[model samples]
Structure formats: C-alpha cells, structure tokens
Target: MINLQGVSLHRGERDLLDSADCRIFPGHKVGIIGANGCGKSTLFKLLLGQLETDAGRVDLPSTWRISHMAQEVEASEQSALDYVLDGDSELRLLQKQLAEAEASSNTDGHKLAELHERMASIDGYSGPARAAQLLDGLGFSHAEQQRPVRSFSGGWRIRLNLGRALMCPADLMLLDEPTNHLDLDATLWLEQWLQRFPGTLLIISHDRDFLDAVVDGIVSFEQQKLVLYSGNYSAFERARAERLAQQQIQFEKQQAERAHMEDFVRRFRAKASKAKQAQSRLKALDRMALIAPAHVDSPFHFTLPSSDKTSNPLIDLREADIGYTDRVVVKDVQLGIQPGRRIGLLGPNGAGKSSLIKTLAGTLAPLSGERQCGEHLAIGYFAQHQLEALDSNGSPLLHLQRLSPDASEQSLRDFLGGYGFIGDRVFEIVGGFSGGEKARLALALLAWQKPNLLLLDEPTNHLDLEMRHALTLALAEFPGAVILVSHDRHLLANTADEFILVADGRAEPYSGDLDDYKQWLLGFNRDKKRKEEKSSTVSGSEEKAPEDKKTQRRAAAALREQLKPLTNKLKNIERQMAAAEKALAAVQEKLADEALYSGGQQEEIARLNRQQSEQQELMEELEMDWLEISETLEDIRSE
Candidate 1:
C-alpha cells in the first residue's frame, strides 16, 4: 500500500503535480489517467524514489515490495526465459549456489549443508515453476524459451522485461500501457491473470477496453490534482461526464450573476437617485470572479480530405510474400481489398500485420507476389513512427508545406490549429514536439493528402481514449479504402469492415466485428492452454480402483484428451465464420462509399451478406457442440 500526502512536483519551471493527495490500497487495482505530459509517469517516479518531492511526503508501507514495468528495456545474449528468470533475484542466486553444490561431491561439509538448505528452500517454493508460468502467460512460446534474447526485436524485449517485472513478489504493481504491443489473445490472457492476481495495482493505459477489463478504480490528474472514481474505465467515463455537466451548470449560473451585476452598475452609475445602488453593484461586480473549471480543448479536427469516388477493384494481391530483408513475414497469400473497403490487419506482435499494410501501400516490395491497384486509388500511408521519421530540423510549417504544397496560407493555419498547433508551435522544429504532437502531425498530414486508399499502422498510439474514439468516427466516415493495423480493439471494431489475422506466414480472414474477433481469440487461447496441459502428461499403468484420487485424476485426464480435438475443430469453424462476417462488413462499407461517390469495383454486398449468414449459422452449431464438450469435461473435473 502507498499514499501521497500533499505532494508537489515540478519540472523545468512547470508544475507537473501540485499538492495532490491520494491513497493506493492493497488488493485493489487502480488506473492512473490524464492527458499526455500531465505527470502520470512523474507520479510513478516519485513513488519509486526516482524523482524528488519538493513539497510533501509520499507515504509508503514500512516494508513493501513494488515492481514498475519499464517503458525502455535492455537485455542481450540471454534467452527470453533466462532474462525473465532475473525477476526473482534471490532465487536466481540461490539456484546458482545449489547447482554448484550438486555438481561437486566433495565440498566444505559445513558450507555444502548451507548450500543444500538454500537450494531445498528455493525448490520447495517452486520458484522456477513460477518463472515459467509468468513467461508463458506473457506469450513466450515454449519453442522460443531457450532462444537467445539477442534474437528478439526491441518490442519483444519489452515483453521480456514485463515478464521479469511480473515475476517479482510485489504487493503493488505499476504498469504503463502494458497492452500496447500485445495481441488480442495475449491481452485477454493478461487481463484474466491480473484479475485473479491478489495485489494492489496501478496501471496507466490509453486503452478503454483494457482499463475496463482490469481496473476496479480510476484516479485522474486534472488541474494539478488527483480525482478518484470508484469504478472501472467505463463507469468513470460516465461519472466524469456527469460531473462536468454539473460544473457547466454551476458555471452558467455564476456567469449570469456576474452579467446581472454589471448591468445594474451600468444602469445606475449615471443617476444620483441610484448612486448608492450603483456603488453597491460596482463592488459586487468587482468581487464576483467567475470560476473557470479545469478543462482541455481536445484538438485535432481530422476529416478526410475530399476525394473523388474510387473505381472498382481497389487492390488485388496474388501469391503475396511481404517482409523485409531475406525473411518473409507472410507468404503465398491471395487476397483482394476492394474500393471503399475498411479492413483491419490483426495478429500477434511480429505476425506481419504492419508488413502487409506496407506492402499494400507499395512502401515495401513483395518478394514474389503480384499486386495490382485500381485506376484512381491514391494511398495515404501512416507509418507507425510517422512523426518520428520526419526531418527534425524542419519547422511544423515547413513540414506542412512540404506535405501539402498546394495549400493557401489561411488553409494551412486552419489545418495546423485543428491539431493544437498554434502560431509558435507551427514554426517549431519537429524535433521539439512531444509524442502526442508528433502523432497529431502525422494524422494532419494524412488528412491533407485525401488519398482514396488509406494505409494506417497503429495510428492510435500516443492518442488518448477520446482522440481514439474521434479517429474511429473519422475513419468510419472516410470515403475511401482503408487498411489499418491497430492494437485498439475498439477502433478496429468501429472502423474496420473486415479482419485479416496474419500468423505463421499466412493470413486467416475473420469477421471484422471486434466482439466476434474477441470471442474467437478467447476460444483459440483456451484451446492452446488445453493442449499445453495435455502435453504435460505422464504414462500410467492400468490399475483397478474402487474409488481413489488417482482414479479421479485419470478420469480428468481422459476427459481433457477427449475435449482437445473437439475444441480445435470449433476454433477452425469460428475462424471461417469470422472471415465471412468481416468480408460482409467490408462489402457493406464499400457499397455505402460507392453509392456516395462514383465508379467503384467490388463484390456485391447482398451476396456477401447471404454467405455470411450461412457461415454464422454453421459456426453457431459448432459452438454448441464445443460448449457441450467443455461442460462435460468440467463436470468430470468437478467430480
């Protein structure tokens, strides 16, 4: 448990947090939220003793354990499991001593006994089992457990660090955007694990769904203070809205009072009969200082630039193999994205979602595939590190001018203002901008292009929940073909017409409906977990028993084995249904866009919808079978 009493923190002449009081209790999960650069990370640092407390105290437990997930990570030469094993520092050391003792028969008798005791203590605690459990939960496949950490990319290394952090014995855990790089299945698994974990938790995430899934409370920083809401993200959002509306009403009442006082003074000031009244009103008006509630102007007006209607057949890929260097992330895929379609690329990290989008954008060359584009499709490609890739020395105005050379002065200023860039900000070099600023700039550039085919890769990064919602709406309204890769499930649900889940060098189309995709992801994960448990088995001799624990265990194992293939069959069915439904949605969005504009090629929506309905019915039947099998297995386990 931790508490902050009258804490004030300042950075570079600006107050990040001011005299804020808060309490974080054990066994309760909380989420910390605010606009970017509003002291979320700074508050974490202050708690961790990594920052200075200029004014007050950050009270913590007399003896406590805390682990904060780091944004940056460092590890090399070790495998993923090896690095994560470092989480239990004492256990790692103890294990080393034990290994040395076991290797030698002759040793200092007294020292050997001590080392044996320590090793026995660690083994009894099942420390290694705990480490392996955490690693598996965080999505490290068994095959990659012994692979060197140097083989993984930076994002994967971050996951390793996260696992290490989680493996520690902590009363409180602090996580910042832990789900940012995780896939749907992995995020869901983490949410389940954290929900069942007994500890105090504080997480900072921009994801609405993830916040809702994991937190029991929300603490927000506004006006240099912390405001508490005793509920998850959705509940807090509703409460915050109500509180704002109440404040708005109070503000209006005060404004009216001040207006009345000013009017009375103006009317009575010139009349001797009303001189006393005039003076009284003047004093009242002077004393009446209106309270302006703390607020922010959600900037960035993102509307797709006016684009001409697209012709049919937006893009067609034949035998596509997309990747960088000599490795192919995805290969031998035949797919087509039609005009006005809004499709989302879904997959685990390193599963080629980004690569597929880049290939579609023509930014990356396919190793062997033939890609054909429609006659009038102009692509607006938004890279993951769009703003970071900009020329840092170039001012905002210069960047805008280079990106949109035909824009008039007034138009340029208006566009910049929409993204919260005022006069001076527009002239500031890209190097000086913050993460949020960079993201806004990339969006602005994309909107200015008015491309008929928009390729967006993780555009939701660095954006707040509201901004993400707004972007979803804008993309939904876009009169063009959109192919996006995003970790935000809500955005994918609202904007994408279909889901293309890439994995293991192949693509499986799923119903673009976000909820549908989630259910499928869950089933898939459950199946994989069942398989792992089944594989961790031992051969047993046939033995008759009247009734015993071993007999029950054998029955449970048998039930588990019977359920595996059935569950796997269900996953395959769900995959088919998901793909059909997604393609239907894509057809609908495309048709709607075509109707608004002109000359778009694509499959007919009616036919697609009919096919999707058939797939849905078949999938429902398979799900029923799966449910029966799972329930029967549970019954066996319970018995």
Candidate 2:
C-alpha cells in the first residue's frame, strides 16, 4: 500500500498540495485527475522519490518495486524490442552474467548453470517475445520493432517508452497519460492490458472512457487537497456534481440570511428603540462566515463559428487514392462530406486515417481521383503540425489579428478569452506556451475563421478534461460539417454522428459505434496474427505439403459454427449497449442545459438523474456480457 499523510508540496510560489492526504491499497487501480498543472505528475515524482516533500511524509513499502513510464527517450540506435527488454534490469543483468561466464577462458560450469537457472526463474528467455508483444499492442509492426529507436518519430518513440514501462516487472506502476500518443485501436488494446495487471496502478489521464474502463478508484485534485473517490471517472463526476449542487444551495441560503441582516441594520441603525438590536445585527453579520459560491464552470467556453455561405456537399472524393507519391495508403475511397455532417475516422495507426483527412482538407492531393469542392466552401483544417506552425514570436492577439485584420482588438481579445486566453495572456508570446495552450490557440484560430467545414486530426492531443469538454460542446453545436480523427472516445462519442473505418488500404463506413469498432479490431488483429503465423510456418517448411483445401474448409466451417451463437449474442449485446449509451447521452445532453441548474427545476433534474443512472447501469451490464462473450470467442479462435 501507498500512503501520503499531511503532504504539502510547493512549486515556486504555488501551493500545489497543502496537507493533502490519500491512501492507495495493494492491487488497486486508481486514476489521478485534475486540471492541467494540478500536480498530478508532481505526485508521481514524489512517489518515485525524485522529489522530497516540503512537509509531512509519504509512506510505502521499502522493498516494493515501482515502474513508471518515462516522458522522453534519448535518440539511440537501440532496436525497439531491445529498448523495451532493457526495462527489465534484472533480466538484462542475469543475461550479461551468463554470457560473460560462457565466454570466459576457463569457464565455470556451476556459475554458468546458476546464471541460467536464475534467468529461467525470471522467464528471461522469453523477454524478447514478451517485449515484441508489448510493441505490437502499441501499434508497432514486426519489422518496425526491429528498427532503431532513433528512427521513429516523437509519437512512436513515446509508444516505445510506454512499451518499455509495461515490460518492467513491478509491484506498483505509474502511468502518466499512457494513451495520449496511442491511436484508438492501441488505446483499446492498452485498456485491456491494464485491466489484467495485478499490481497497484496509478494513472494520470484525461481520457474519461479509458479511465472508466481501467481504474476502480479516482484521486482528484480539488482545490489544494487530494480527495479520493470510491469509483471510476463517471462516478467521480456524479459525486462532484452533487457536492457542488449542495454547496450552491448553502451559498444561496447564506447570502439570503446575510442580506436580511444587512437590511435590518440599515433600517433601524438610527432608531433609539432599536439601536441595540441594530448593533447586534451588525455584529452578527460581521461574525457570520462567508459561504463561497460553487464554481462548477469550465474555464473554456467557445463555439466553432460557421460561415453564412451555403454548401450542399462541402467536399466530395471519387475513386480517391490517398497516400504519398510512392505508395497508396487508402485506395479507391468514395467519400462525400455534406453540410452538418459529423464523421469520425477510425482505424489502427498508419491505416490512412490521417491521410484520408488530409486529402479531404486538401492539404494532401489524391494521386488518382476527382476532388470536388463547393464554391463557397471554407475549410478549417487543424492538425498537430498546425500548432507548430503558429508564430513563436506572435501573441494570441497578434495571431487572431492577422486572421481578421479589420476586426476590433477588443473583439479578438474576447474571442481569445473563450479559449482561456484572458487579459495579459492574450499578449503573451506564444513561444513560452505549453503544448495544451498551443493546441488551444490553434483551435481558437480555427474557430475564428468561420469555416464551413472543419477537419481536425487529433485536436485534443494535449487538452485537459475541461478543454476537451468545451471542444466537444463546441463541435456538438457547430452547424458546419466536421471530419474528426481523435483517439479521445468521449469526444468522438458525443460529437460524431457517423464513423468511417480506414483500414486494409480502403475507406468504408463502419456501421457500429466505438464499442463495436473495438470488437471488430480484436477479430481483425486475431485474423492478421493467424495469417502471419501461417505465412511463417509455410515459409519455414517448403518440403511439407500444405493442408488439403477440403480439410482447411471443414476446419474453418467448424470454427465458425462454434463461434456463431457467441458472435450473435455479442452483437445483440453491442446493439443494446449502443442504445443504452444513446439514452444516457440524451439525458446528459438535457443535464448540460444551464437552465436546468439555474433554479426551480428540482423535479426535472431528479427525473433526469434517475434516467441517467438507469442507462448507466444497463450499459455496464451489457458491457460485462460483451466482455464475457468476447473472451469466450477469443478462446475459441485461439484454439
């Protein structure tokens, strides 16, 4: 178990934590959540003993092994698999000793045998294979795993870092935004992997769905204190909402009482008969503690401005091959984007989701296709690269001013404020901004142009929960067409009306939601693995004849027959889950209305709350069924 007692941490003048206390038990999975710069990472560092607390104590077992994902990796020629394997220091040490003993001029047989036994005890011989699996689950291909670590891009390197962290054996694991660099498929894979981990896990993440799926508890940074909740992110949200609602009620009542006292003092201060009463009222008012109003509002609040110009189909592509000059990534794609369309591109990494989006945004031209655009079509394309394109020397005000030269400075400042750039922040140079700030600035610029169509590629990469929620709300209200490629499931679920699967060198409609897409990915990956295994086996033994076609067909038919009932049940569960989610989303949409919280809507709010709980429970039950059937299906497929 891990415990922090009266822990107070200070960064510069900011008191990140003051007398914060929390305890995490063995084999517990907890999520650390808060706004950006809320000391989530700082707390992890404290656990790792990299930083000493300014006050109080942090306690843990002295012998417990801890593993944490590194934020950055130095460029090196180490193979990705080797880098991951290096995470197991003990295994590497044992292997080194064994090699040295064997290579000695006068070999010590007993020492060599002892080293080998120790290695075997740790299953070090299979380290390479295990590392490869981690890499594979993180979106690295077989050939790519053998490539030098220095050869991969920044994001891939981060995945390699995550793989390394998973490779390590530990009693406690600390993962900070483990899914930030992963695609949806990889995120799903990691979710399943983390679910099976037996050790105590503390993850700091903004992805609510991932947190809900993996973590059983939540440790939130509220004010300057660490408050631990008993359930997942959804539970935490509901709990916080209720707490804030109560706080609001108390504040209103206190204000009314204070106002009554002040009025009494004002009306009777000069009357001789009531002079003593007035003085007492004034004293009572002074002694009364102020109840601060609950601030449940998000710092971010903005809408994606849409153009007034009309366009039926914002963009159209026919027989499009989207990729680079030498190779086509997604071939023969037929896609048409109409006004008010909300489409999410889903697939494995390097499966041409970004390529397709780029082509649609007209940033990447199709090799062979007819790309049509509406005459008044204004495309607002946002990508990670755009964040880099921002002028480092320019301020948020300057950036917006360049976009709208004739617009008033006050108007631009107000616009920037919606993106959390207020007052002096709008004039601050962009060079010193953090990644999340840069991403927000880029988005603010995108929203300012009033585009008829928005193409966003991983726009929420560095955003926090508040910013993500704000963006989701903005996208939900935007009237123009949107083509989004995001790993954030909450954003996709709430904003996207349809999904397009880009995989196997083709782009097509995926007739299911994210949950169904996850199921498809599992089967897709299993089949791919089987194909690879078959290809390897056939190549290794050319002399052996292949299996008879009739026998192969019979075996395949038998497997399908065995899987039929389970597959059908899984599909039924998925459909029900989707329906439950839709209902929950509807209730949530109603709950999001500010008017519901204003006043005099207690009955309506209660009804919505009950409905939300029911839908959530139903969704949870269906998910459990889906998981059980999925596991059974996987077992059959493996056999």
Candidate 3:
C-alpha cells in the first residue's frame, strides 16, 4: 500500500497540493488525472523519490521494487533489445558477474554455481525472448529490435522506453502518459498488458478509454487535493458532476441563511437592547465562512462550426496512390467521404493512414489517379506537424485575427476563451506555451475556419483529459464530415461512425469495430510471423552451407574489425554531446531566472551568456562529428 498523509507540495509560489491525503492499496490500478500542469507528473516524481514532499509523509513498502517509464532517451547506439534488457538491472549485474567469474581461473566454484542459480531463479536465460516479445507487442519488428535505439524517431523512442519499463520486474509501476506516442493498436495492446499486470499500477493519461479499460479507481487533482474516487474515469466524471451539483445546492442554501442572518443584524444592531445580541451574532459570523460552491471549471470548450455550404460528397478518391514523390504507400484507393460521415483510419504505424489523409486533404496530390472534391469543399486539416507551423511569436488572438481580419477584438477573445485562452492569456505570445497549449491553439485555429470537412491526424497528441473531453464533445456535435487518424481509441470509438483499414499497400473499408480491429491486428501479426518462419525453414532446408558458414563467419569478423574505430568514435561523440547538452540546459535554466534581469546582475548574466554560447558551439561541433561517424558506420554496415 502507498499512503500520503497531509501532503503539501508547491512548485515555486503555486501550491499544487495542500494538506492532501490519499491511500492506494496493493495491486490497485489507479488512474491519475487533472488538467495539464496541475502537478500530475509532480506526484509521480514524489512517488519515485525524485522530489521531496514539502510538508507531510508518503509511506510505501520499503522493499517494494518500483518501475517507471523514462521521459527522455539518451542518444546511444545500443540495440533496442539490449536496452530493454538493461531494465532488469539485477539480471544484467548477475550476468556481468557470471561472465567475470567464468573468466577468472581463481574464482571459487561455489560462487560460480551460486551465480548460475541466481540467474536461473531470475529467468535470465529467457531474458532475450521476453524482451523480444515486449518489443513486438510495442510495434517493433524483429529487424527493428536488432537496430540501434538512436535510429528511431522521438515517438518511436518513447515507445521503446515504454517497452523497457514493461520489461522490468516490479511490485509497483508509475506510468505517465504512456499512450501519448502510441497508435490505437499499440495503445490497445498496452492496455491489455496492464490489465494483466500483477502489481500496483498508477498511470497518468488523458485517454479516457485507456483508463476506463485499465484502472479500477481514479486519483484526481481537484481544489489542491488528491481525491481518490472509486471506479474508472467515466465513473469519476459522473460522480464528480453529481457531487458538484449537490454541493452547489447546499452552498446556495447556506448563502441564503447567512444573508438572512446578516440582514437581521444590520437592522437591529443600532438598538441598545439588541446591541449585545448583535455583538454575539457578529462573533458567530466571524467564525463562519461563506460556503463556496464546488467549482468545476474547464479551460477548454470550443465547437467546430459547420460551413454554411453543403455537398453530398466532400471528397472522392479514385484509383489513388498515396505517398510522396519517391514512394507510393497505398494504391488503388477508391473512397468517397460524404457529408456527416465520421470515418476513423486504423492501421499500423508507418502504414499509410497519414498519407491517405494527406491525399484526401490535398496536402499531397496523388502520384497517379484522380481526387475529386465538391465545389464547396473546405477542409480544416489538423496534423501533428501543423502545431509546429503555428506562428510562435503570435498570440492566440493574433492567430485568430489572421483568420478573420474583420472580426472585432471582443468577438475574437470570446471565441478564444472557449479554447482555454481567456483574459490576458489570449494576448500572451505562444512561444512560451506548452505543447498542449499549442495543440489547443492549433485546434482553435482549425475550428474558427468553419470548414465543412475535417481531416484530423493525431489531434489529441498533447491535449490533457479535460481538453480531450472537450474535444470529444465538440467533435460529437460537429455537423460536417470528419476523417480522424488518431491513436486515441476513446476518441475514435466515440466520434467515428466506421473504420477504414489502410494496410498491405491498399485502403479499404473495415467491417469491424475497434475491438474487432485489435483482435484482427493480433491475428494478422501472428500470420505474418508464421509465414516468415515457414519461409526461413524451407530456405534453410534447401541450403547446403557446411563450407559457406566458415566464409560467412570470416566476413563477419572482418566487418566488425573494420567498423571498430568508427563505433568507438561514435560513442565518444555521443558522450561529449550529452555533456554539452546538460551544461547548456543548466545555463538555460539559470537564464530563465528573473533575478538575472534585475539590477546589479550584469556580471552574472554575462557569465551565463558566455557559458551558453560555449555549450551551444560545443554541442553543434559534437553533433556534426556524431552524424559523420554514424553515416560512415552505416556505409560500412551496408557493405
């Protein structure tokens, strides 16, 4: 069990939690939820012992092993499988000691035997198979597992980190936004895995369906308190709404009673006969505080306005080939997106969901075939990349103003407020905003256009639960057609009317729901693996390679020897790059200090500036060297 007693936590001046108390029982799956920057991640840090509580105690079993997903990935050339295996630190340490024990002739035979016993006890021999299973489940193929971790994109690296976390043996696990980087399929797989985990699980996620499926209870951040609610996210929402409603009723009653008492006092306090009574009443009033109604305020609430125009078919694709100029991903796609149609795209990552959406949105023209659209087809396309395209220096109001120049400032502010940029926030520059803020602004920009057709790809990537709930409601009420490509199963299940599967170089309608699709995906992967294994078996049976094996070994040795220097250089540069980045980040943190801008800090400011400049230069130089070495290593491996 984990218990927090009267916990008070503060981030600078803002008190995240004040005298909050909560207890999580053993093997309980608790979903942590709140608005972004409401200290959900900070709670996880406190549990991980990375942050100390300001005032109160957190009690957990001292011997319980805790595991957590890493937020950052170091640039390393370690294979994905090896990196995941490293999560079992004890196993790795045992293996290392065992290797040394075997290498030393003077080592005690009993010590060597004891190491082997420990390895067997820990299932160390099956470590590789376990890691491979985790990798495959997390959407990595056999080839990709053998590939170095540095080769993956940021999202893929996040998946790798999740896989590593899952690979660790733990009594308690802390996962913060595990589904953020995942596609719908992988997210489903992870949900199933967590459901079967025999440990206490605490997850902070915005995906409601994920929490609904995986958690038995919820821990919500509200009114500077960690309130534990029984049941899943949906249950918590309904219960909270009901509770708040009841609270409002009681508060109103209390306010009326207090008003009556105050009015009586004001009218009679001037009389000498009632003066003593009025003084006593005033003392009683001083001891009482006005009951505040349960405040449930969500910073996000915006709807995608429907275009005034109408068309039966918003978009049509005939024999289309979707992809870039150099490659075609999905071919022979015949589809029509009609008005009021809500179609969700489902496929493996790297498959052609985004490509197909791009083609439909006209962001990428088809390499072959034709795309026909209605005369009034106006698309409000939202993609992950579109967030970056936002003008960082511009405020939310400015972005909206660029959309509708003739609109009044008050009208724009009203519109932006629904998307969570209320009051002075609407005028603040977006450069300092968080990713979730940018995503909301991007969506806000998309909403203001009043497009008839919405093509959204991973639209909820950075949105918090409240924002996601707001988006879900908005999308549900949207009058126009929507083609969504998202990893958020809850969003898809709630908004989409049907599923379109894009795979195997083609796009077609899938005659199944999300659950059915998940099952199909598992079967599809199994069939593919089986076929590959059969083909390998057949090819092996036909090979007469007794002598060729010796030649292959010799060539492998020669390649390894040739790549040794480049590998060493790559590791060295990676270390230097990491160091430079750490130093740069430290300087940047200091630069963020408000004191640096105050009077008499010119010398300190100049020193930090010089340090920042030097670190940046060093990082750039190391990065170039790292890239050159990586490319040379790739060339050697290709040879």
lDDT leader: 2
Q: Pairs clashing in candidate 2? A: none
**Top candidate (TM-score):** 2
lDDT of 1 by residue, 394-445 (tens): 8777878997688787788887787777887788888877777788788887
69: Cα error in model 3, Å: 1.0
**Model 1, backbone clash pairs (residues 3+ apart or across chains), number:** 12
> Candidate 1: deviation at residue 298, Å?
2.5
lDDT of each: 0.70, 0.82, 0.80
lDDT of 1: 0.70
Q: Against the true structure, candidate 3 has what lDDT?
A: 0.80
> Could you tell me every candidate's TM-score relative to the true structure?
0.73, 0.82, 0.76
Q: Quick one: ranking by lDDT, best first?
A: 2, 3, 1
Model 2 Cα shift for residue 209 (angstroms): 0.4
